[model samples]
Target: MRVAVVSESFLPTVNGVTTSVARVLEHLQRRGHEALVIAPAAGSPSEYAGAAVHEVPAVLYRRFPVGIPTPLVHRTLADFAPDVVHAASPFLLGAHAIGEASRLGIPSVAVFQTDVAGYARRNRLSAAEGFAWRVVNLVHDKADLTLAPSSAAMSDLAAAGVQRLARWGRGVDLDGYHPRTRFEPEVAQLRRSWAPNDELIVGYVGRLAPEKQVEAFSALRGVPGIRIVIVGGGPSESSVRRALAGMPVTFTGPLHGRELARAYAAFDVFAHTGTEETFGQTIQEAQASGTPVIAPRSGGPIDLIEHGVSGLLTDPDDPRSLARAVTALTGDAGRRARLGEAGRRSVLGRTWESFGDQLLSHYESVGARGPVLTRALRKVDVD
Candidate 1:
C-alpha cells in the first residue's frame, strides 16, 4: 500500500508525537510498503531507511518549536497521491491530509496524540481553550477513520462527533530503551561533578512548556533531601527557573543513547506533572529502566498507571498529591523496587510490532468495507 503520513512535527524535534510517527512510518516501510511523509523541512527524515520524506515549506512559530502555528500542506499531499493518508496531528497539516485523501478517493486516518485544550487550560485560558476539542473533531470528521492513542482521548473524540474511531495505541522502543545499570565512568564523573552523593534525585522528562505546568517544580522546594532534575529543553526553561526561585535543578539538556538510559536509571523515581499527555512516554522509559513513575491521575497517565502496582497516579492539580505520591514511592526501598520491577514489563502489549499488526488489520478491514457488510447483515436480520 502507498501511505502518506503527514504531520507538522517530525524527527530532530524530540517529543512523543514525532517519535511515535517515525516508528509507524518505519514499520510500514519494513513491511514492504511504500510510505511517504509530508511535513516541514525543519528536521532530518534520513533516519528511515526506505521511507520517502517530502518536506513542504512552512513557518514555525518563533517561540514554539512543537508546532508550525500556520501552514498549507494540501498541495504537497495532493501531489504525493498516496492510497492511505495518516494524519499524525489534526491541525492544518491534518486538514490537508483528509482533503487530499478525499480528492483522491483514498482512505484517510487521524491520530490523536495530545490534548490541546487541556494544554490551554494549563496555560490559564478557560473558555477559549475549549475549541481544541471542537477542532479535533472537525479535522477527523473528514477522515475514513480516526485513531486515538489512548482510551481517554477516544471518549473525548466520540463526544466531539468522530463516529468512526478506533484506538491505535502507542509503543516504546524496547531495545533503544532498556534496563542498563553502571552509569559508566564518564557519566558518573559528570554526575559527581554536578550533584553530590545522597541527594535524592527526582527526574522529570519532556518539554519545559507552560502547558507542561513546569512551574510545579517549585512544589519540590519543600521536599527534604531532594534534587530536581529536568531532562528536556523547551521554551519555558528560563521562566521555569525564575518560577523556581533559583531552586536546584540540573537540566541535562536532553540526553540521547546510553546517557539517556542512565538518566532514567539514575533517578530514584519519575515525576511527571503534565495533565495533557496523550500517552506520557517518559513514564514508559523510566519504567523500562526499572524506575517507578509518580504521575497524575488525569489524562493518559490514568491509563498508564495502576496506582501502587506499576506506579502511583496522583491528582494532577494538587502538588501536595504529587509530593505525597513521590514521597510514598521513594520512601520505601522495597515498595519502589517492586513497583519499578513490575513497570519494567509494563509495556508488554504496547509495542510497535503488536500495534502495527493490529493497525494493518484495521487498514485491511477499511479497504474491504467491513462496516458495509455489517450493516447489510443487520438489514437482512430485520428482513
Candidate 2:
C-alpha cells in the first residue's frame, strides 16, 4: 500500500511526534509498503527509511517550525496518488494535506497528538482556547478517521464534537532502553558526571518549553542528596537555567540514540511535569529503561501509570506534590525497583512492529469502508 504521511514536525526536531513518525516510516518500509513524508523544513534528510521526504516551507513558531502548504504539496500527492493519507498530528501542513485529499476524494486519517486548546490556555490565550478547539474539530472532522493517542485526548475531542475517533497508543524501543544499558561503562561515567557522587538522580526529558511546565521541576532543588538532570532544549532553556540557578541541576542540550538511552537508564527516578501531553513518550521510554516514573495525575500519564503500582502519579497543579513523590521514591529503593520492573513489564508488548501493524490495519479498514460508507457508519456509531 502507498501511504502519504503529512506532519508539521519531523527530523532535526527531537519530539515525540517526530520520533513516532520516524519509527512508523521505518516499519512501513520493512514491510514493503511505499511511504512518502510531507513535513516542514527542518533540514531533514532527503530520504528516510527509503521513503522520499518532501520539505515544505515553514515559519518558526514558539519552539519549533510550523509548515505552510504550497502548490507543490498538491502536485506531489497527485503524482504519488497514495492509497491513504496519514496525518501525523495534522495542524499546518497536515491540515493542507487533508484538504487536498478531500478534494481528490482520497481517504485520510488524522492523529491527535497535541492539545491546542490546552496550549492556548497555558499561554494565557484563554480567549483563543475556544477558537483552538473549533480549529481542532474542523481538521479532525474532515478526515475519514481520527486517531487519538490517549483516552483523555479522545474524550476531549469527543466532547468537542470531533467524529470518527479511535485510540492509537504509542510504542517504545525496549532493546534500546533496557536496564542492561546502565551497566555500560560509558553510561556509568555519564552518571558520575551528573552526580559526581552516589547522589540520587532525578531526570526529565522533553522540550524545555513553557507548556511543558519544566519550571515546576525546580521544586526538586535543595532536596538532600538529589541531583536533577534535564535532557532536551527549547526556547525556555534560558529561563529554566535561571530558575534552577544554584541548584544541583545539569542541562544536557539534547541527546539521541545511545546517548538518549543512557540518559534514561541512568535515572534513579524519571519525572515529567507536563499536564497537556496527549501521550508522554518519555514516560514510556523511562519505564522501558527500567526506571520508575513520577508523572502528573492528569492527561496520558493517568493511563500509562497505575499509582503506587507501576509508577506514582502526583497532582498536576502542585509542585510540592511532585517533589514529595520524588522524595518518597528516592528513599525507598525496594519500592522503586518493584515499580520500575512492573513498568517495564507493562510496556514489554508495545513494540514498533505492533504499532505499525495496528496503524496499517486502520488504514486498510478505512480504505475498504470507502469515504461515503465510512462517514455514514461513523455517524451512526457516534450517534
Candidate 3:
C-alpha cells in the first residue's frame, strides 16, 4: 500500500518521534510498500529509506522546529494519492494531513505520541491545557483509527472524548542495546572516564525540555558517591545546567547509535523524570541495555515498570522520591543487578520488527475496512 506519513518533527531533531517515524517508513519500504514523509525542514536528507521526504516551512519551537502546514499540503498529498494516511503525533503537520485526507475521503490513522496537556501544564500554560485537549480530540476524532503510544495516553484521550483509539507502544533496538555492550573494553573505559573514582554512574537520556522535568534530576545531587550524566540537548539545557551547578553532572549534548547504546549500557541506574511521556522509548532502551530504571509512577513508565519487579517507579511530583529511589538502588548492588536482569528479560521480544509488523497489520485492517464499508453501503443502496 502507498502510505503518507505526516509528522510535526522529523530527522536532524534527534527525538523519539523522529526516530520512530524514520523506522516505520524504513520498514514500510522494506515490505515493498511506498511511503511518503511530510515534516518540517530540519536539514534532514531529502530521501529516507527509499521514502521521499517533503519538507514544509517551519519555525523554532523551543529547541525543535515546528512545521507550518499550508494549503499546499492538500495539493501535495492529492498528487501522491495515498491509499492511507498515517499522522504521527497529529498536532501541527499531522493535523493538516488528516484534514486533507478526510477531504479526499481517504482512510487515515493518527498516532498520539506526545502529551500536549502535560506539556502545557509544565510550561505554566494552565489555560491552554483545556484548549490542548480540545485540539487533540479535534485532530484525532477525524482519523479512521487513532493509536495511543501508551495505556496512560489512551486513557487520557478517551477521557478527552477522542474516538477510535488503540494502544501502540514503542520498541527498542535490542541488538545495539544489550548487556554485552557493558562488558566491552571501550565502553568500560568510557564509563571509567565519566565516573573516574569509583563513583556510581546515574544517567538520564532524552531532551532537556521543561516538560521532561529535567530540573528534578538536581535532587540527585544530594546522593553521595554518584555521577550524574545527562545525555541530550534541548532549549532547557542552560537552565538545567544552572540548576545542577556545582553538582557532579556531566552533559553529553547528544549521542546516537552505538555511542548512545554504550552510554545506556554504562549506566548503573537510568533515571527518567518526565511524567508527560506518551511512551518512554529511552526507558525501554535502558532496560534493553540491562540497566535498572527509576522512572516516575505516571505516564508511560506506569506501563513499562512493575514497581519492585522489573524496575522501580517513584512519585512524579516529589524530587525527594526520586532521590530516595536512587539511594536505595545505589546502596544495594545485588538488587540493582537483579532489576537490570529482569528489565532485560521484560523487553526480549519487544523489537522494532515486531512493532512494524503490528503497525502494518493495523494499516491493512483500516485500509480494508474502509472499502468493505463502502461496498456494504453500495449494496444497501442497490437493494
| Candidate maximizing lDDT | 2
Q: Report lDDT (CA) for all predictions.
A: 0.73, 0.88, 0.87
* Clash list (residue pairs), candidate 3: none
Q: Which tens-of-lDDT digit does each residue in 21-91 have in candidate 1? A: 78888788778777777776676665464777766666666443333423345444445445567888767
What candidate 1 gets wrong by more than 4 Å, as runs, is 65-79, 123-126, 182-194, 368-383
Candidate 2, backbone clash total: 0
lDDT of 3 by residue, 1-383 (tens): 77888988888887888899988988888888888888988887898999888989889867688889897687667667677889998787888889888877668989988888997787788789989999999989889999988889989999999988778887788998999999988889878889999688999999988888899988887789899999999889999999899999899989998899999988999999998888899999999999999999998889899999889999877879999999998889999999999999999999888999899888876763344453444344335
Worst 10 residues of 2 by lDDT: 368-377
TM-score of each: 0.89, 0.94, 0.94
1-383: candidate 2 lDDT, tens digit per residue: 77889987999887888998999899999999888999999899998998899999999888588999898888787767677899999997898899988876568999889888988877778779989999999988889999998989989999989989888998899899898998999888988899898889999999988879888978887688899999999999999999899999999989998999999988999999998999999999999999999999988998999999989999976779988998897789999899999999988999989988999888987773343553454344335
lDDT of 3: 0.87
Q: Give the TM-score of candidate 1.
A: 0.89
Q: Give lDDT: candidate 2, residue 59.
A: 92
Error of 3 at 38 (Å): 0.8
